[model samples]
Target chain A: MSTEVAIVGIGMHEFGRTDGVSGMDQGVVAVRRACADAGVNWEDIQFAFGGSMAAGAADTMVSLLGLTGLQFINVANGCATGGSALFSAYNTIRSGVFDLGIAIGFDKHERGAFRVNTKGGGLGDWYGASGLALTTQFFGMKINRYMHEYGITQSTLAKVSEKAFRNGSMNPMAWRRKPISEEEVINSPMLSYPLTQYMFCSPGEGGVALILARADKAHLYTDKPIYLRAAVVRSRRFGSFEVLAPSIALEHNAGPTVDASKAAFEMAGMGPKDMDLAQLQDTESGAEVMHMAENGFCEHGEQEFMIQAGDTEIGGKFPVNTDGGCLANGEPVGASGLRQVYENVLQLRGQAGARQVPNDPKTAYTHVYGAPGISGVTILSR
Target chain B: MSQVPVTEGVFTWPSDSPQLIGSRCVACGNHMFPVQQGCPKCTAAETEEVLLGRRGTLWTWTVQGFPPKAPPYAGNVDPKTFEAFGVGYVELPGQLKVESRLTEADPEKLRIGMEMELVIVPLSKDSDGNEIVTFAFAPVA
Candidate 1:
């Protein structure tokens, strides 16, 4: 087996409300679809890594998928669960212990704002009882400060969501398919100051699975294997602004997304300019705007200009979120990160139909940022 | 009704001037609120409890426009009676910014870098009709 790992197959369960369908059942469908795509069977998967934050234990899926006794570790990294699972599977293959493995993520969440488990999140009961535990508040405050320091306008935030829905209209699996105008997004009911209801992605259900194979054997599985160039996860540094923090250090510093993105690019021997397209986390419109700079796609304030110029549009200089990102797809914590990777894989393979980025992109990048200040970044090449 | 702090040891109670209880890292001089054990910055085990400054500037803020869920949120859940509250981080000079509820809920009343002072306010009431109080920051008039 070669040291390099490649994704030979990919599959997904439609991202949205699926009444009466279990989250684990979605994962089983995705796994089966991926197996069929790669012309492999369940027993061919030597090892696996998967996770579902709100759903049942990932390892228990074996009861339905056949208990092959393969080592399947459950990962719980909040919103970075999918990326963490993919990272683990990549390393498992790179370590030469397994030639084939699967990384799967699925989740079903209650409809409404995600209730923070104060005690589980390392916070006290008073922290939540005092009504200071909402993640939307954190996003609003952080972006409010960012807009103040960076001169970004509320219109820019609206534009980002407008673009998300526009792209989502073209994605078959996206939850929100109708195009929303910038004016509509800005005029929507204010969930938080400067953030309208349209700007935030709700918690929902979905599942994604990818089959990995050693690079040397990748050709045997499929001719369109997407090589996994890099996969890295990073936690927040001391002074970075993170979700659910009761306090912040006076000395501000770079966030985890910046760290993870830099490390992923370095590992791939490429730079942001080398990427033909990218999929940055857009849990909220502000997150997409801030993460553009955090991922080194452009400087801190350049998004104001790039956004206005439509530089991030599907046909623009650098396409982003061709699969509508979390904003349009809604975030199923465990599946959100892998959804980014799945989009990049589809874009790189030139299978992204209407939302396909121009120029037959050869390299793609993805970043996912989540609560308690952790980020995951991945680089893929066709 | 008798007044009681929502949680003990978070801040000095029953005093006219109450300061938040935080820990200062002896190794790196880093400060954190609500009293954590180790230094998150320098990872030093040695630290000392210190009272944070009462006055600070609003670092950033937003409004909790909707009523949050119960259990974790002890505040009023009645959408009609639930008043919107300002949530923000107040930057204490040379120390750290503590996240707190702002007395002023109007967006026009709050601004980044505005001076704010800590004050005790009623968060809710317990089963016995005792008022549960929590610390918050108010814009200095």
Candidate 2:
């Protein structure tokens, strides 16, 4: 029988752009907090996984945590590195190879870069060596297509941004805590066609640390342990996008988010209907609605309707990104996945103060996607 | 005009005219543009190279209105320089849709499903004056 893994403790530093501290410093603080919260000494962590995209020096981040005794593996999967690290730690515990593991994800604003790795090449490469690092441009392409196909108006897209900013106001950790007006979002500087500055996720710095332990050891750590019901990661099969009909294949690797969600649901023996809440990698406002439909939260082309009906609000049918997603909370790259997990853990543990779901969410899911078609999905249950 | 090196120095072009080099999978009969390292359909690395059709139909196109923020993009012009550049997907005879920049700047002149031909243009010159050429598509006569 396979052993089960549970999140015994979680800790997060403030989320925002930082220039005062190093990424390693942010990671060490969160790691220390998680260890203290779990009542486990730092020396007890058998393995450490550090997730960072631009931190170039990952090993130094691990050593800064004073976890020199543990084996360390650094992960840099575009934006999904944090979730990848969490999965690695979960699998390590499940395999009985380690009774305890720590996953640290952190990135400082100063270290942020547009391009991830130039090794394998990417979408920009195909466009004659264009180095467009702001992923908003790609999302802008999708938005343009969406507008062309569904007649979606810029006003509608701005509404999504307004709702996100309003939600962010309740999240003290969010970077842009001040609510934005629809006019502001609409008139914001256009980054790309159909996408404005307000529609893009802000770059920020922060770190999220999670402690995973064997089910038996979980009870010793915290009474509010959230079991890792399911964890799955998948990459896009090369050229899968080219084979589909042009009308259907809107973009490359857009299908993985849905596929990963389905796999996570099957593994957890649940469906979108069973999820009391959801936290998605909302890098942009349009992405929140797009991914919701793709993940089966709503029918295709019905996301706009759902949003207009307030079904995604705090007291609606299903609350999404209640802690404010990357759009409002800021995209720290390596720390995003763990940030979602952190929100899921808090909601499941009845710890989310202002943004708490009413019915006491027993189950929740977090989906994250990285560049070049990397994706991760995790289901959490109390 | 300066001397430009053609496929003559590398592999022989199937036709005297410009044609794109591509590969076709024997397993799934899938067509790949710019030729893939392996067959994405069946993962069969064994494939045959074939010349793609010179003429195609435009699927959709967009003009980059701003300069890209990253490297390898040699166009040092300001963001406004891209205010009229065009990029789009064109469907070839084999139902293959390939993405390429358009030769024309007027968006109104470009139409979906319009017949087009592949044209390789000089992207930039290296320090040694070696002209680096890339592919773009223009309306076919």
Candidate 3:
């Protein structure tokens, strides 16, 4: 039987802009802080797996992290980069080859909507020329169809953002920490139909790192080890509606998030109800609403009532995005997934001071979805 | 006044009623737009080119409220002059849902499951002063 892995230390650079600091430098800071938290030396880490989208090579950090000459792999799986890095580190320790390692992710993106190059994104010139390559349009179109089908109201959408900012106000690391009223959110500039400016998460900069060790030896690093129950990544299946696609087949199919969520629950031997809290991708307000259902937390059209009932609030039945999530953190792409993991670790260990949930949470779940249709889900427990 | 297609094989040109070009799998019957070599559903290698239907229903839509960045974006840059455009997926019966621009820019004017017909509209002008045309879907009267 394969051995289990446990996260002994977690650290993060505040999720937002840091003008002068390079992305790689932020990563180094995160790694150092994680080492300090785990009470382990940099020389103790046996291997490393890291990723960054627009930042420099992750392996180059060894110049400052010390020339340990350990095996380091760079992952670039779009928005799932952090989750992919953690998944690799988990499997490595489970294979019994390495006793300890670290997974890191960081990115610094330019202002405004993420630009998709026609040739690089595998899209034809006509696609960009006609303005069909924008990611915001996809989000708006998707939520528009969903609202029509499920009877979700505009107020529900605003509520999701309101909760994000409210929770963000309690968390120091969040970029958008000021709470905006629902009316203000609705009255905000409409970037896409039905989605206001406040509803969207901007592209920003930050870094996060987590140190993992074999479950048997986890006690050597920290007293409270957060066990990693499962880490799974999945890609889009046939006929699924995804970004950058010019056409979709008539046959409908579930998106990648469903497959990844199911596999994660099965692997962890737990259900959605068992999760004390969750951190879901909130690229925009609609994403969180749809992802909640897609991850099997609720059925389609249930988010409308769930948001109204305040079930996803910090004091509610099921707290989500307790660290403000991507909506408040301002997604740094590479660091976004690991930021979720970091927040879960803090919450599971009861270290989240201001943003702590009502109950002492033992189990946590995280899900992230991004371009080209890929999703990563992870389950953790104290 | 000279006019040219933005890209060939996307949609037929110089016709009163134009249809989009797509690929259909010979083995599994999967359809894809702008033509491709293989099937994404059944992994079938053999496929045939076919002309898609002219009329379809709006599957979903949204309005672009601001101008996109340049390099990839080849549209009007001035924010004050940039016109918000409607983008949507038009599902042709028994074929596939093609993502395209809608002639209508007003979100209030568009609705789900509305009947739409294909039209070729001028997107922009090339360096040679030729009108570059592309496919779009318009609400049918």
Q: Give me the runs in candidate 2 sitting further than 4 Å from their true place.
A: A109-113, A122-134, A147-152, A242-254, B3-17, B55-63, B77-84, B103-117, B120-133, B138-141
Lowest summed lDDT across 10 adjacent residues in model 2 chain A is found at A242-251
TM-score to true structure, per model:
0.99, 0.87, 0.99
Q: For residues A1-382, write the lDDT of model 3, one tens digit per residue.
A: 9999999999888888898999999999999999999999999999999999999889999999999889999999999999999999999999999999999999999999988877877779989888888899999999999999998998999999999999999998889899988899999999989799999999999999999999999999999999999999999999899987899887788899999999999999999989999999999999999999999999999999999999999998888888888889998889999999999999999999988976789999999999889999999998
Report the number of backbone clashes for model 3: 0
What are the runs in model 3 whose C-alpha is more than 4 Å off?
none
- Candidate 1, A1-382: lDDT as tens digits: 4499999999899999999999989888889988999999999999999999999889999999998989999999898999999999999999999999999999999988899999999999999999999999999998999999999998999999999999999999999999999999998988888788999999999999999999999998999999999999999998998999999999888999999998999999999999999999888999999999999999998999999899999999988888889999999999999999999988988999999998889999999998899999999998
Q: Is candidate 2 or candidate 3 better by DockQ?
A: 3
For each candidate, the DockQ is 0.89, 0.26, 0.86
Query: Arrange candidates by DockQ, highest first: which order?
Result: 1, 3, 2
How much lDDT does candidate 1 score?
0.93
Q: Which candidate model has the greater lDDT, 1 or 2?
A: 1
Error of 3 at A95 (Å): 0.6
Worst 10 residues of 3 chain A by lDDT: A114-123
